[model samples]
Target chain A: MSNTTHPDTSRSSDESAHAEVTVPRSPELEVEQEAALRLWVILSRAHAAIASHAHADVARSGLTLAEFAILEVLYHRGPMLLGEVQRRILVSSGGITFLVDRLTAKGLVERRNCDKDRRARYAALTPPGEALVAELFPAHADAITQAMRGLAADDQQVVAEMLRSLGLHAAAKPLP
Target chain B: MSNTTHPDTSRSSDESAHAEVTVPRSPELEVEQEAALRLWVILSRAHAAIASHAHADVARSGLTLAEFAILEVLYHRGPMLLGEVQRRILVSSGGITFLVDRLTAKGLVERRNCDKDRRARYAALTPPGEALVAELFPAHADAITQAMRGLAADDQQVVAEMLRSLGLHAAAKPLP
Candidate 1:
C-alpha cells in the first residue's frame, strides 16, 4: 500500500504512474486493483440510495439539500463561520456566498460581522429558522435512521469505524 | 429494524413517521439516529477523497469522469445498452443521450442497431476507444489501488462486503 511497494512502476506518489514496461503484473496486484475498483462502485451505490431517501425528507421541508445541511450544522453547533459551513458540507451545491445569499433571502438565516476579526463573518439561523429546524430536526434524523435500517446495528457500527479511517487517510496529501 | 418495532411514530413503511404523541424516543432510538448521521458524513468524505484520485487519473486521459465511466464499463463489460450504462453508473453527469453524443463526436464510441430488436441500440467502443482503454486500464486500476491504499487489503474486502449488503437493502422498495 505504500509507495515503497511499487517504487519502480510508480515514480510519484501524488501522480498515477503511467504504464511502466517493467511493472510486474502480479496476480496479487490484479486482485488488489479489482478489489479497490469494486469497492468504489459499491460505495457509490450505497451513498446514492441513502442520499435519495435523505434528500426526499429534506425536500418536504422546502429546503434544498445544501441549505438543510447548513441549517443542521448551525442547529447542532450554534453560529459558525461561513467557510466552516462550506467545509462541513461534502457537496456544496454552489459557492458558499450563493447558498448563504439564498438562505438570507429566505429569511431563514442571517449574517453577522465578527468583532474580533474584521475579515471574518458568521452565519446564524434566525429565530424562525431555529424554531423551524427544532421542529423538523428530529423527523429529519428519523428519515436517515429509516434509510439506513437495512443494516443491523452492529453492522452500522463496523461500517462507521471503517469509513472514518478510510476518509482520514484519503484526505491526507502524499508527502511531496 | 422492522416496522413492527415503531408502528406508532412511523406509520408508512416507505415514509418517515412523524412525531407521534405517544411514541417513546428511547435512548436506543437516539443512539441509532446519531450513528446513521455520522456514518453518512464519514461515507461522503471517503467517497469524495477516493473519487478525487480516480478522477485525476481519468482527467489525464482527456476524458471527463462520466465519459470515462461509460468507456470503462464498455471496456470491462463489453458493449451494453445505453440505458444499462446509465444505470450502472451511480452518478450520471447528464442525460445518457448527451453523454453518448459527446463520446460519438470524439469517435471513441459508435452506436449499432441491436440485431435482436430494432428499437434497442448498443454502444460499442470503436477501435480507437478499445485501444485507448486497453492502454490506460492498467494504470487506471493502479490509481484506484493507490487511492485505496489507506486501508489494509483485508479491510477493503470487509468494506466491499458490507457495502454490498447495505446497497442492496437500500435499493429495495419499502412495502407500502
Candidate 2:
C-alpha cells in the first residue's frame, strides 16, 4: 500500500518539469513527515511478508485463511454468535455467512438458535471441527514463531508496545 | 489476518472435552510464541486501520487505490518500466496493464517504448498527472501524519527502527 504520509521531496529526475505548490514546511515537521512515511512503508512491507507466509501455511492445510481464522476463534473462544465471530475476525457479514455455510457443509461447524433472541444465531464447532483445530493449532503456532524468529525477545516486546499504540490510535475516530 | 502464532493455552470453558495432543513447549519458547502472536495481531490491526483510512482518502479523490499507487510511483520515480512498476507496487502484471490502460484513458499516465528493449514499456505521468499529484500529495501526507499522530516523536522513532528490523527480518528467507 502506498503510505501517503510524506510528500516525495527527494530530487526526482523530472524535477524541472514537476513544480511544488505547497508552501515550505518547517524543518521539524518535514523530518517528522518523512519519518512517518518511512515507518508506514516498513510497517506495510513487514505485514505483507509475514501474512503471505502465514497464509500459505494455512492454505497448505486444506483450509482457506478465512476458514482457519473462524476455526481458530471458535477453538479459543468456544461457541460464539455469528456476529461476534465476524467482528473479531474482521470478515464481512456476507463473507462470514458464506464461510459458515461451507464449514457447515463440511460438518465442521453447526449453528444453534439463541434461546432469547430469534434473530441471533450462534456457531459452534462440531466434533470434527474441534479435532481439526486441535490438530492444526500447534503447527500454526509453529509457523508464526518461525516467521518471527528473526526478532529477538527485547525487540519483540518493543514492537508489541509500539504496534499496540499505533493500532489503537489508528483505529480510533480521526480528530475533529 | 489470523496471527496464528500463539496457542491458546488459557483454560477453555469447555476444557474437559478439548484436550491437547502436541507436546508441551518449553516455558521460554511458549513465552516467545505468545509474544510473536501478540505482535502479529497488533501489526495486522495497525496496518488495517491505517490502510483503510489512507485508501478512503484516496478514494475520495476520484481514484481507486491501485490508480493512486500507480500515479504516486510515477510522480516519485519518473518514467519506470512497466515491470518495475508492477514489482514496486506489488501489483500483478495483468493488473498493472489494466491500471496503466485506465490511467492512459484518463489522460493521467502515458506509455512509452523502452529505448533498449523494444518489447518493454514504461509508464509516466502527463502534465495533468503531475499537476494532480502535486495538488493531492500534501493532503495525502497530512492524512498519514494524522493517522499516526497518537505516537510522540520518540515513540515514532522507536517504531520506525523496530518496524525496519521486523520488516527486514520477516522479508528475508525463512531460517532452515
| Predicted model with the maximum TM-score | 2
lDDT by residue (B1-176, candidate 1, tens digit) is 00000011212233332233335678888778767777776776777777667667777878876778778777666787876777776444355678789899999999989998888789989989878977887787787788788888789889879877876776673521
Task: Provide the overall lDDT of each model, using Cα atoms, as 2-decimal numbers.
Answer: 0.70, 0.74
True contacts kept of each: 0.40, 0.41
**DockQ for all models:** 0.25, 0.42
TM-score of chain B of each: 0.81, 0.82
Clashes of each: 0, 0
The candidate maximizing DockQ is: 2
> Candidate 2 chain B — worst ten consecutive residues by lDDT sum?
B1-10
| Predictions in order: chain A TM-score | 0.82, 0.84
Q: Residue-wise lDDT of candidate 1 within A31-106, one digit each (tens)?
A: 7876787787777777767766667777787887678877777766678788777777654434677878998999
Candidate 2: where is the Cα deviation over 4 Å?
Answer: A1-21, A174-176, B1-21, B174-176
Per-prediction TM-score to the true structure, in the order listed: 0.83, 0.86
